[model samples]
Target chain A: MSTAAIAALTAILLVGIASTVIGIVGHRARRTSDFLVASRNVGAGANAGAISGEYLSAASFLGIAGLVLSDGVDALWYPVGFTAGYLSLLLFVAAPLRRSGAYTVPDFAEVRLRSRGLRLVCTAFVLVIGWLYLLPQLQGAGLTVATVTGLPAWTGELGAGIVIVLSVMFGGMRSATFVQAFQYWLKLTAVTLPVIVALVYFLGSGHTYDRPAPPSFPERTTVDVHTGVTLQAGQDVTFTAAGRIDGRDVAPTEPQTWTAGSRHVVGEGTDLTFPAGSAVPVVAGGPVADDEWLLPLSGADPHQLLGIYSLIIATFLGTMGLPHVLVRFYTNPDGRAARRSAVYVLAMIGVFYLLVTLLGALSRFYTPQLLVGGQTDAAVLLLPTAVLGSGTAGAVLGGIVAAGAWAAFLSTSSGLVVSLAGVLSTDVLRGKRLSNFRFATVLAGAAPVALALGVTQLDFTETVALAFAVAASTFCPLLVLGVWWRGLTAKGAIAGVLAGGILAAGAVGVSLAGIAGTGVLGVLLYRPAIVSVPVAFATMIVVSVLTARERPTDVDAVMLRLHAPERLGLSRDAVSGRDRAELDEPAPDERAAGPA
Target chain B: MSTIEERRADTGTVYERVQAGPEFADLRRRLRRFVFPMSAAFLVWYLAYVLLASYAPEFMATKVAGNINVGIVVGLLQFVSTFAITTVYVRFANRHIDPAAERIRQQIEGPAR
Candidate 1:
């Protein structure tokens, strides 16, 4: 069969498997309880695996690989931050969150604050983060499909979106748990198998591939800029004079080369064609100063500081607020189970990161030709082919990379769609009604698809990073404060969620309108997580302190419930689905022990 | 003070009436205060990791892992330490926490009398 046929077959088979599992689970799930938290019966190992599967997504698996490949050594932090974010989840929020007896974050807000308004605000934040996260999963699917079959990107996105909607809308968390758990292993196999095969292929080639040597620095002359518009004085901006790589002038091909003085031409009349693989050393002639390390952070030029910050904030905090990630914890039998799952997730993620770094380093050395378009995202896909040469060996390797991409999109999208479906039923539909749940799932799938199609042209990693920054800004603070601080009030949560969510949303909205890079602060604040997260945490603390009187009177009791282990049985009834109404009235002896 | 003591006597009678051992009742008081804050501390430490990663990348960029960098090492440690912490928690639960909780549960339920 052709590659398209094979991929289509695989897609159908996987979706069929997911649908069957959901069908079995969904039939028995008649109540709101089943749809929200899977009746709280999942075991530790399975939950951990599912969480890992969900959390890995396109971002963790492919995005990290892509990042490490392009950004040299600094990119390793992406996976580190992604994994470590869970430690924060485990240490502070897991047990208390479980004990709260709330299905979603909004439920916790409403119940804790006794305010519908607070619930609505939180619901809005969840929707924004969920949508932002989902967009990349779709984009990933599109890219993967395009890579594999030479088909349109929309074909893969639409195919994956349709599958997710059908399965999740009908199935809910009970279904999502099984599929996500299975996908983790599939993803691992998909990624690791190709690398192993490629390694073998590399060996068979007699270990004699011509590895491109690093550019020699001593012979190359660079031009130093004595006068330029200084963002920070004393920080030298050295432009490279016209130079040759393989006997061709490399400077005209890379305007950002040490060749251009303080300025490069932009807009219609400017020269555009540049040699794709040419590397320009940005800070080559200077003693690089403070914050000079983050030159790509500037939105004014992709070469500025804010650009780097944007990428960092998105990747670092995005791990925390991912829907699929949070939902993975729900599959754990208890809070402790959730915490342990996160632990295992970290280990698994750490190992893959090692390989990612190697792949990145190899790409930098061997495949300078591929970097010509600055299509760093395509490095991992192209690496295998580049190594194997354009033969069946290359096709097989490319196919494997393509499969990995598909897994990233499918796994992450399913997790996100499931979470969105649940939120839609709970928040948008105002109850966990089954029909509403189905509608929410469709909306979840369709909205992202529409957004993906509308913005078919975008930098995949950059767009996804923006989503992460927004997520970190919004939910990270909310989940952290909600679980740990007893003084956290409904108003504070609402304020923080709004402050962070709105700021990030506003940044995204403005960027979409092409208002980015207009000014320095505009560039700095373009990736709002740097500003928004602090604002969020501060908003929560300030509002919470001011509204201390309205803080839950049973905060102490709730804290006890959250802290007490499942072994303690204080909150066992909560996890075991023994509703408060069914809980036997405590005898005097037991009553003396606690109000929790 | 007299009225409070009287109220306690009545409540104490109810405990006996329900057949809950005094030990079960006492466990609730002891365990709540101990576990609540302790767990909360861990959660705070975990959140700090998120805050540091999200808000403090400059600090993370410092080298630690031989081009792996400080941010990468610390972030990766979050995953490694999570499993370590969970293992510690599970062991802690099984050895001391779970057994105490189970004992209380049994005592309160009292084998259906």
Candidate 2:
């Protein structure tokens, strides 16, 4: 096996063993006296770390860099929206959500609207969003492993899936908020070290960025195309080729000419050695030159403006609706702490994303071959060895990057599974047993594992944005109106959620099914948040107004609970509302004695 | 609906009374007054950045410094504004919102705090 592969394997194994051990230990403590107390002890800084850990998924770690490498400066919007989304969350929902005393998104729906039916619908939506979000993380894992190990993607995917399942099953998610917190620091150290080192190297290497042109190989470099790709050649280039080029075999010693503006198809496993200072041949549909890359809205599609708006709306508003995100707020001691936690989250993740963007930029000079191969997602993983060569130091650094990527996958996937299983065990199965929770966990991780293994690999960040669109469409309206507007009825919320969920999820369904057409129709269909968000808001407001009589008479009390200070003693959490395992599922007999 | 009403009667009129009073109104008003205007302000700021990014590509590509452009600066500022707003909001919450809420809670829920 290759040194890069060994380092990556060791990294994955280390993260797996550590997390599972932590999970087992955390579960044992929670089964006894320590769980309930641990919930309230989560400090703002540490909780923020945990939140950031779970929040920075495969998309933030790998996808942003890849998109930036491929699409140019316009891609920075993804990370910006991602970080800025927290600002809205902090302003509008942070304190109120914690004050509302609802742990999960579904729990909040039931708490605010006082509707079981709405809760059930929300349960379904949570599962949908969770699954949609989980798919990309799993796919990202497969991509990372396949890029490193050069093994079939299924092997890496299955390995990551097993680790995630095992960790969550051992009860790592609910009790050990600190484990996720540790993951954040681990990820930070992992990615940060390589990036800082690489940045220094790039600066000292005396490379200049003044020329507005396609990135050329800095040295005599040989790149193997693992998959068939159409290259958009910028200038006439002569390359020694082995394997099929334009459907004919070129011997290793023979030099082949690729004309400028000509689309050249290089078949799988073709090795092309390009001499230094030659203009790079980018993959078809990628930005070919630095000038086109540096400029925003220079995307190939005519409707890119609308697409950016839709993307902004999805990510900016979507943070509040994430299931795993809100569950962490319950761990905060009070509403104030929750708000504080959010601020810290913004700070922590903001720094992390800035670093991530830097990595994306640095990948330009170090690993531009990824641009040709159209697997820019592997840019971070391969950058170390690409710069440092395939020696001991490079392998060790590569291992760190690979481990960080694994942590991203493991933390986010496990968090999703925990929340999904939280909904499933409590709402779906109607059971209080730990076994039921374990079964729910299995179902949660297993379904996405199957889907991730089965589906075609997509641009990781874009797929994640689609999940955000679904969230923004459905739950953004629900949380916003339910907190701010008194007229928000259960039936109205149900209508809005259904309308938004169906429309946004329908769009995801269309795109995932590969029916996405180009231009206006396609961009709108792909990132439908701008349309779906407004439609959901209007539907809820109109329905709420029309059915004013159906409004719950106890709106004042619920509002008081939601908006009032935790110090006021009016905003006590219902036993059924929290994700606390001691108070979780099949309510304790004494609390269950209370009449509806 | 009747079942919910029945449960409300059992809990009695404390919450409704609290919700109706001026203290609670003032508290809610204070929060809404801060968050609404602030949310709008930052969103507009963010929107300006996004719009300039999309419509004014030539402008966005203008280099402000060595290897830095208008687009990159504005994007980084989005980060700065977010952190600044967070700090300012926390200060506002601590000074303006918390003490009043604490006073009201002490008045109603006793001096346990």
Candidate 3:
């Protein structure tokens, strides 16, 4: 077996063992509270780590570097937007959300709006967003394993899906939290160590980026195409080939010349050699030339400005509505703790993203071959091997990064599955038994895995961004209005959610169906948040004002519960002095009366 | 609707008492004061950055320091400003919001003893 395969297998095994160990350690989570929100006793630091772990999905770990390598300086917006999302959460949503004491977004919706119908609608959107987010993670796992092990993609997806399902089923929120927190540190160390070594090597090698030109192969390099790809050659080049070119089988005995300024189809298992100082070919639809790559909004597309603005809007407003992320805030002991944890999350995610952006920039200088192979997502996984070659150091660093990627997939997918299962078991199934939760876990994980196995065309970052846009359109309006504005009647909420959810989901569907043509309309469909979010908000406000009589009479009480700090003692289950004493001691009768 | 009203009535006295109190009003004012202005400022700043990066690429690409352009510097400052805002808000909450909220809690709970 190749070193890459061995390294990748070791990484997967280590992740599996780590998760199992954590599940065993946190095996005592029997109550529904433990299952759903870890008994709401988590500290700020640990919760922050877990939140960071789950938040940095495969998109952040692999896709960001890939985007930076492929798309240029404009891609920096992704990391910036992602980390800045927590700032919005910290400022607006964190404390109030925790103080509201809702276990899920749907629960919050039901409580704040006092409507079961709106709760159900919120639940459906939660599932949609969770599954949408899960798709890229599963697909990214497939891509990572394929890049590292040369194995077929489906194996990795299935492996990640099964592991996440088992772990979530075994210990629910408690185990998932512990495992995710540990994975955060593991991912940090993995990326940090390899980049440090690479940086040292780079400084010693004394390579400079002083030239004003696009990237070229520093030495003769041969790239094996594991899947068929069409290459857009820039200049005439003759290279040795050992596989099918343009649907004709080519023997390993002879060399072939690829003409410049035309597209050529290279079949699977082809090894193409490019001599030193040759410019790398573009991957058909991917970015071109360093000038366009280095400059923001200059990438041969007219809709670039619209795309950037929409992306910013979606990511900026969307994070508070992510089901997995919102549920993590519930694990905090109180509103103050929740706010503190958000602070820590901002710090941790900020430092990690800085390192990730650096890795993306370095990948350009080190692994431009990924850009040519149309596998820029492998830029992170391939950097160690590219710089250090296949020696002991390379294999070890490669194994570490591979493990980090697995942890990314595992933590994120587990968080999503846990949130999905909680919503299903609690709301849809109306069965809170552990058995029902486990069953929901299986169901929640199955659809995404099946979809991931069949679909392979979407970019990882773009898929995740679509989920964000939908969430921004749907729940951002709901939460902002429900929390701050007393005029948000139930009828208005339903109209808003339906309008936003349908429009955004339809845009995604159109884009997915490949029916969107390249122009303003196409760009709007591709990035719908700019238009759809305002439409949802406006529809909600207008409908609410028209149906003002339908507003809940208890809006004052619900708003008090949400905005009042924990120190306010205004929570629904507030105990009298005697009851507080009984609760503290937990006598037999008190134990019996405790939450089920 | 009847069931909802019954549930509301169960907690009605406490909600009414809290809402009637001055401390609760003070707490609301303090929180709104901190969040409203902060949120507006941050949104405006973020939108400006996005618009500039999209439409004013030449400005964003101008060199700020050696090997660092204005865009990269501004991007890094985004992180810095986030941390700064978080620190300031945490301090603000601890000093102003928490004490007022604590007073209201004591009043609603009718004395810790």
Candidate 4:
């Protein structure tokens, strides 16, 4: 086996073992409260670590660098949008939602709106968004494992799925909090150390950073293609090929020159040698010159104003709505701790994103071959070896990165699955027993793994962004208006959620099916948040105004509970205590008043 | 205190009275004072950055220093601004919002020790 592969295998194994051990060690959850919300006793710093850990999915760890490497400065919007989402959370949703004392988004919806139907609607969207988010993490695991070990993609997906399901099923939220917190530090060390090493080495070598165009090979470079790739070259050139090119097989012992400015097909299991100073043939998308790459929003196609706006809107508003992220806020002891944890999350996520962006920019110089192979996602994994020349240090760094990637997949997928299980067992399956939770965990974790095995073509970050867009459209309005506005009727919420969820989810569906043509329709469908979010908010407001009489009788009490801090010596504890008692009894009318 | 507890036990009256009381009002005002304006300003600043990046490409690409263009600086500042906002809000909340809220809580739930 290759040294890098061995290192990656070791990393994956260590991550899996460490997470499972942590899950077992922290397995003290004996009640529903422990399983669902960690008994709401987590402190600020640890919860912050767990929050950042789960929030930085494969999309942030691997996809950001890949996006930056391929798309250039415009891609920086993703990291910015991601981190700033927490700022929005800290300012608006964090404390209020925690004060509401809901375990899941659906719990919040039902508790605040006093409607079973809205809860059901929220449950469905939570499942959809959770599964949508889970798909990419699964696919990314498959891709990472394949890149490192040359194994079939499904093996990695299956491995990550099993590890996540086992740990989550064992301890649920209580264990997940500790596991995710550990993962935060693991991922930080994983990405940051190698990047610092690479940067110092790069600077010490006195490499030129002033290149005015798309990256070219700094010297003779050989790229091995594990899968077939179609590439477009910008200029005529000659190179050595020891594999199949353009459906014609070339003997390994023989070398051939190829013409540029035309499409060339490199078959699986081929090696292509490129001379120094030659432009890397663009794959996966069109060729981008260096000048366009360095400029914001000017790469290749140049007119993505609408797309950029859509991304900004989706991410800025979407963070508060993610099921995994929201559930963490429930682990905080009080509303104040929720807010404090968010502050810590902002710092943690911001620092991590800064490091990943640096890695992305550096990959352009070190791993341009990833662009050629249409495997930019591997840039983070392959960068160490690329820069340090495949020695012991490079293998160790690659191993650490591999471990980080595994941590990303495990932490995120486990969070999503646990939240999904909480909602499913509590709401849909009507199962309060721990065994039922385990069954729901398997069900929740299995669907995404199955879907991921079949759907491998979607870009990880883009798919995750779609999930965010859906959340932004559906839940952002729900939480914001639910917390701040009292005129929100259950009927209006129902209508708004339906309108927004359907529109945005339909856009995602159409985009996924590849039915939206590459025109205005496609752009709109690919990023429906700009239109869908407004439509939802307006629907909610107009409908609420029209149906004001349909507002819940308990709206005033719920508002007081949400906005009033726990320290405010109000009836919050009395209400919460009563709510908990009502929950234990489980009467139909009292169920809505119980802790969700 | 017993009367207060009894009043609070009467379904919604305790919260309603607290909501109308000076401490709760001060708490609400303090929280809203920070969150509302801060959210608006941040959103506007963020949107401006996005708009500039999308619509004003050349201006964003203009070099600010050696090898550091306007876009890079602005992107870095986005991170800086997030940290700055977080630090400022944390400090502000500790001093302004937390105290008011704590006072209200004391009025209702009594002292923490």
Each predicted model: what fraction of the native A–B Cα contacts (within 8 Å) does it retain? 0.17, 0.66, 0.51, 0.61
State model 2's lDDT. 0.81
- What stretches of model 3 exceed 4 Å from their correct place? A222-272, A284-287, A513-516, A567-569, A572-596, B1-14, B20-22, B64-66
Q: How close is candidate 3 to the true structure, as a TM-score?
A: 0.91
TM-score of 1: 0.72
- The candidate with the higher DockQ, 1 or 3, is 3
lDDT, model 2, position A294: 66
- Relative to the unseen true structure, what is the C-alpha lDDT of residue A487 in candidate 2, on a scale of 0 to 100? 96
Tens-place lDDT per residue, model 2, A424-507, is 988999766666777888898889889887666678898899989999999899999999999999989999999999999998
Clashing pairs in 2: none
Candidate number with greatest TM-score? 2
Model 1 residue A279 CA deviation in Å: 6.5
Residue A43 of model 1, lDDT score:
70
Identify the runs in model 2 with alpha carbons over 4 angstroms from their true place. A26-38, A219-230, A240-256, A262-273, A576-596, B1-11, B111-113
Write one digit per residue (lDDT tens) for candidate 4, span B1-107.
Answer: 46456655674766677777887777777778888898788878877887787779789878775456888888778888987898888788778877777676666
DockQ of each: 0.16, 0.48, 0.41, 0.50
lDDT per residue, candidate 1, A410-514, as tens digits? 667777877777777766776434677778888888998988887633345556667777887877787777765778988888888889888888887676554
Can you give the lDDT of residue A524 in candidate 4? 77
Error of 4 at B76 (Å): 1.4
Candidate 1 stretches with Cα past 4 Å from truth are A1-32, A197-320, A456-461, A512-514, A518-523, A567-596, B1-113
Error of 3 at A274 (Å): 2.2
Q: What is the C-alpha lDDT of each candidate?
A: 0.58, 0.81, 0.80, 0.82
Highest DockQ, which number? 4
Error of 4 at B106 (Å): 4.8
List model 3 lDDT by residue over B68-111, tens digit each: 67777777787788788888898899889877777766665555
